[model samples]
Target chain A: MRLAVTGAGAVGRSVVELAGEYGHEVVAVADSSSAVVADAGLDPEALVTRKAEAGVVGDGDPGDALAADYDVLVEATPTTLGDAEPGFSHVRTALERDRHAVLANKGPVAERYADLRALARDGDGDVRFEATVGGAIPAISTVEDVEPGHVTAVRGVLNGTANFILTRMAAEGLDYDHVLAEAQDLGVAEADPSFDVDGTDAALKCVILANVLSFGAADDPADAREFTLDDADVEGIRDVPGSALRLAAEDGRTVRLIGEATGGTVRVAPRLVPENGTLAVSGTQNIVQIETSHAGRLNISGLGAGGPETASAVLSDVGRLG
Target chain B: MSDAPDGAPEDPEGADEADPAVDGGHDPGSSTHTVRLELVDEPGQLLAALQPIADNGGNLLSIYHERGNKTPRGRIPVEVDFEATADRFEVIVGALRDEGIAVMQAGTERYAEELTLLLVGHLIDTDLSDTLSRIEADASTSVADVSLAAPQGTAEASSARLRLEARTGETADALETVRGIAEEKGLRVVAPLAGVET
Candidate 1:
């Protein structure tokens, strides 16, 4: 497959490396700083060095450089769902050119799923976004497996940094600040952790889920309720007697960062599960449990976040396309 | 703004000569209290925790059940909120412990809002279940709902959209946390468009 990769961030970098290994011809690479194109094929190793030196990837703007010939346009730009003009432009151009697309950026899809889907259909191209949600988890596939009419609700722990911090707090009894610092140091969190803590990320995700399960279209991020872990009073959890200790009680259950969409409304928050429940065992592990009208309750849990794991998912998509 | 003379509108009929004991009914300034408790993994643990609040003159307002998670000791953490007088609040805490419910943390603070996210990826192929578990471990957030779609099987490239709600105004952090997962798992994030002013 001839591929054009946009963004060059962590996921983009992984896609480039994997696509090269898979013997796919990476025709062009786009980013904010620079764009690299090769007729024969660019060396992933050399491109990495160039990216580091140039401090950018792809063309500064979406123009002929990205709109050039390609079989598949792989988008991996920074996700800005509502205001992702750059990603949207790049994707729109690729689709307009009758190229297939595999997206890692959430901005374009979250904001314009319906339009994009329609565009893809009109262009007779495939747009697959397995990496958009659940990291390496095959959540979309799971939902697809069940009868759409039978599925009643969807829920899970969708964020990793917040979970990492919560795990640290649960294990070490550390404050939010300390746990967050540790997450950054461990590379589990970003330098700017606002998105993870503020819940905007989760809201965007909810919009996507609602689109897939209910409307067959994504909703506006503004339409969903938003919250963040930062608003939680950890000190309050400690100040009260038996508060912190109860989390570790012999029969206590603790599950953090939960999201649920039931009926017509979608809600997300932190919840304490009863011991002996499936969620109670989901410690530092990403889990998604779906309740359906026919399947009752089904739970899926695994390591949904990580480079190699996510790369494998992308590779799977490439294989399927092949 | 007009200023009326003190005691000028005093009307004999409007004057209440009722009992002095009822001078001030239900002090509006009275502070509400909250309690955090840990319960054994039992079916009625939540009910056991709530009994204390009701028995101690506390009106239940909210409850935060940190379940489907575990502590280092493998126990569950639960946060409960209720309205009560200062004296009655303390009694509620005592009653919870007496009923064998592990009290974790409690105070006047309440979870005013929650945020949720749906993650789509090869959750099973990439071990997304573990990721969900890790996310739920965060004290600030909890796994409220999940929906998985793996029509091609777990090993195949698939997507699972997870919904996660966090404390009020914590959506940014929640998404960031998810971004970390996306970065780690190489998953494409397709929703929650940025800069939409949600």
Candidate 2:
């Protein structure tokens, strides 16, 4: 397979390396920085060295540009909702050029789910965004494979940074600031950190999940209720004896942020699960527990937010496309 | 007559009449404001934070409660909007801190700008996850998007293109942060060939 990658950040780089390892030919690589096109395929190791030499960061149009003949387009650019100029433009261009698109960016899907899905439907190509929801958990693919009547609800630790913080708070008794600083130091959180902490990132993922599970509702993503724990009273919990435990415990069950869109009302929030529940034990790792009407609850867990993990998911999608 | 003495002719209508100054006091055209707050993960955290806003006469618009989402510090991010006087807004924010909710941004007007950059290298073999984490940690930037391709397997070196969204006016700082990570991990930073605003 001849592949073209847009965006040369962590996940993009991982896709290149992994695809190369899987015996695919990486033909073109693009980023905000210079795009590199190689006829004989570029060496990943050397490319990394070159990027280091140049001081590059953030997003821009692909530098090297895409070849008309590439078999697949792996879209892994930064996510920005409402503003569809770069990511939307890039994906649309790839699809227009007849390349199979494997999207890791949530912005395009969250903001333009209908338009992009329609484009895929109209074109003689396939578009997969499993990496958009869970980095390596295969949540989307699992849902796709289930017997239509078997699956019920999808829930888990969709966001790793939040889970990590909660875990630290629960086990280590660390203050929020101290734990967050440690998370930053450990590469578990971003510098701006608002997206992860504020619920937008999770909301975007929920939107993607809703699309996958709902099978294309012609509704706006903004309609979903997005609530972050920011406004919740933490001190009040301490005052309420066992409030932490109670918050984590419900109906004699532990809790997790569960996103359910069954029967129309799409809800995403922290809900209590039984202690014996699969999601309760999901821990800091990224886990997706899909409860089908028949299959009951099936849990999938792994490194959910890392670049390499996301790249691997993209590779899997590419393989399927091939 | 003696008790009615000096300053006023006691008209019973004086107390019943509405003061002209008081009648014209309220304005309906004031714009509503929203604040984005980042909170650390803990039990019963949000309630304490809301006390100040409620006490200070801030009308609650919406609370984006991302309990499942965590910040780099393992905290949750929350966005709250309210209608209040500008002077009262400050009091609400102060009261929130007094109750202990970390304010990430008080207003929607972004103090941070966005910059996009590209990275090229053997991202997989070199542990692209670590590389991304490092850059994000340094510049307080987020991994917005990443596109990668390797026709070959993991052992074979391949290149990836990354799209990063960093803080506004912090592009230079973000780039420096990426540079440090690239150097440490032996990755290449591909300077933008064509520049465009994010």
**Lowest-lDDT window of 10 residues in candidate 1 chain B?**
B1-10
Interface RMSD (Å) of candidate 2 = 21.0
Candidate 1 runs further than 4 Å off: A57-65, A216-251, A280-284, B1-198
User: Residue B112 deviation, candidate 1, in Å?
Assistant: 28
For model 1 the local lDDT of residue A229 reads 26
Error of model 2, residue A264, in angstroms: 2.6
Each predicted complex: what DockQ? 0.03, 0.01
lDDT of candidate 1 over B84-158, digit per residue (tens): 555676677667656756544445232233433334446676787788877766655555445454544764445
Give the fraction of true interface contacts kept by model 2.
Answer: 0.00
Candidate 2, residue A259: how far the Cα is off, in Å: 3.6
Expressed as tens digits, the lDDT of each residue in A187-215 for candidate 2 is 88787666765556666676667666555
Q: Clash number for model 1?
A: 167
Candidates' C-alpha lDDT: 0.61, 0.62
Candidate 2 regions exceeding 4 Å error are A56-64, A147-150, A216-255, A261-263, A274-276, B1-198
* Candidate 1 chain A lowest-lDDT run of ten: A233-242
